[model samples]
Target: MMKAADLAAIRAIITRAKRWDLFFSLLGILSLMVGVLTFTVLFVDMAIQGVPRLSVDFFTSFPSRRAEHAGILSAWVGTVLVMLLTALAAVPLGVAAGVYLEEYAPKNWITDIIEINISNLAGIPSIVYGLLALGLFVYYFGFGQSILSAGLTLALLILPVIIVATRESIRAIPQSIHEGSYACGATTWQTVSDHILPYSSAGILTGVIIGMARAIGETAPIITIGALTFIAFLPTAPFAGDPPAGLFDWIFAPFTVMPIQMFNWTSRPEAAFTVNAAAAGFVLVFMTLAMNGLAIYVRYRLRKNIKW
Candidate 1:
């Protein structure tokens, strides 16, 4: 019913709007490209500097006073051990707490307070966690400078992250799933175990991977717990037959992780150690990327398989 002139004006306005939308879209793409380019440049630089240092001996030798002789054997082993301990300590507790909060906790002021505090904890600085670990795990609890203490400290740091992820994943499921489980005479625990947990497993795992990835790169909390920067010897193996430090002695032994070692190298006056630092940094980045890739794969598989 519009006049020709009015219709033409309307078309012109829509055309202008579309042009602006296209402009913004291209701007966003350009911004993303900038970030990608920066990362690629840095990665290529590190590869150029560090790839020559990636011999088998580099992975098998211990730290030394000489830059050429120093290696990351102790550092990488300690990193893996600390990560195992952190996972054992954090994952179950985080997942359980998340489940309780999302599925069981009554909606009340206390619950609201708890939820708010959890979210706040996630945003708190990592150094504050280090300070707390220094006070409680290092001094009060007297775990000393052992890997056990470091693991527990890192566990506390990542708990909120895992809980938040679990809750968010569980929340994504339709309420009808819960209703149907209940209609079929499933109890609350049964419903969660059989219906919610299974469906949310992928999300929970992604969160755990992300959390552990963060934990592996943490330096402050481990350092605050009095971890050595120059550890040159491996911890007693969990199951060394000859010396028999027992199955759990390694957990109680002093240790150093890759991040701490890399930090030490980067601080050195020598130029060669800088290359060592770059190599260690490359390893850390590769590990983090692998974990992230696993998370992405998990999410994709779950999304593809699960209808709802």
Candidate 2:
């Protein structure tokens, strides 16, 4: 029933819209390729400059003033221990706070303010956390420049991220799931434990991985709290000390992480130290990738078991 002129106008509009769509589509592809290509080039350059320096001894030997002989033994070990402690300190608190906020806390202006503050915290610069940790963990609490202090600092840094991730993940569960659990005469805690927690665990782990990846690479906070740049020794091994050191004694040991080691090497005058820095950077990236890969695999497995 349309007039020929009206039909022609409609066709013209469709053509114009399609042209704009094509333009945006091409723009998006260009942006994605730019990022991918940039990363590929940088990674390849690092490998070309660093791969030859990697060897079995490079992993085993302690750092030395002689750059060619230096290794990351202490750096990597401290990174792992600090990360382990970070996880221990952050996970439970983040998860519990998230659950309380989402599942139990009353909806009110007070809760809104708290939620807004938490979200804002996620965007606060990492250096501010470092300053706070320096004062509270190092000077105030007398934790000193130790593994425990570093661990707790990084834990604080990532807590907001974990809490937000947890809330979002729990929010994603179907409303029907909660209603069904309630219909079965389940209590709030029971419903949450058996239904909510299991379903959202993958998402929670994803956040944890992201937070940890950020924590592992952070140098500002660690350095602010007096992490040594030239740690040639490892934390004292428990039960191996002359008097058999207490299990928690290592928590108070001085520490260093990979980024700090790389920073130290890169700042040196020698070319060999530059190569060492590149190699350490390569290994740090690999470790981060491996951690993410493992987390992705675990998330996939978790999702596979999910009924919906």
Candidate 3:
């Protein structure tokens, strides 16, 4: 309803705001420069220390006397298995709980309590969760210092991450989809399962993957549950033996993981141990970056493809 003259006046005022654009651009460019430079320095230092130590034994042999000994085969195997198990245990439960709370729960006190606690839990120091795992998995029920204990501790540590990610994804869903499903006479579960979930699945999965990546890097909690620095036997499948090491049997067996092994090496009296430690650090960094990159790529595609 504004007159042409009025519109022209407003446009003139808006054009005046562009005068500060250069300042903002300079600030953004400077910030980016600083970040890149800092990371470049770190990468250079790590590479200089680690690349020379990268050898056949670094990947193939068990830890030995540094220059005389090589490889981290056992620690590598343990870390992968524990991380995989933690992911397997965390993703489904976290997503399901998120979905139920977001889509099905009455907006009541109990639900609010859960929502608040889950957010709060994410901020709790991971080492505290390790203590809880120690009490519950190692002492109270008697699983003891095993890979199972590490996985469970890690699962708890990452659950909050998964839940928070899932909840945000579910919350991001457009309400119109829910209303449309309701209009079509779908049951609450059906609307959530067939429509709402499919719409937000990509986001949920991305969050879970990020959570898993963080869990894979964690050392404090797993250490609290007593991840051994040395385990000679490669882990057999939990239920593959003659007695089929019952869930409790395998879950409580003493085990070693990569981070713990690195910690042990770093504490040793030899310079070779320090070099190997750096190499292991590089390996962890590379693996984490790879997983995070995949998650980001997936998120970009999902955002591009999803309607909302």
In order, the Cα lDDT scores of the candidates are 0.92, 0.92, 0.82
* Candidate 1: tens digits of C-alpha lDDT, residues 253-287: 89999999999999998999999998988998899
lDDT of 2 by residue, 1-308 (tens): 99999999999999999999999999999999999999999889889888999998888889999988999999999999999999999999999989989899998998999899998988898888889999999999999999999999999999998999899889989999999999999999999999999989888998899889889999898999888999889998889879999888999999888999999999998999999999999999888887778778877886787666
Worst 10 residues of 1 by lDDT: 236-245
Q: Can you tell me which runs of candidate 1 are displaced by over 4 Å?
A: 1-23, 239-243
Candidates 1 and 3 compared: the better one by lDDT is 1
lDDT for 269 (candidate 2): 87
lDDT per residue as tens, model 3, 25-105: 889999999999998887777778877888877787776654457667888888887887798788888988888788778
Q: TM-score for each prediction?
A: 0.92, 0.90, 0.85
Give lDDT: candidate 3, residue 161. 81
Cα deviation at 66, candidate 3, in Å, is 4.5
Off by over 4 Å in 2: 1-24, 296-307
Cα-based RMSD of candidate 1: 2.4
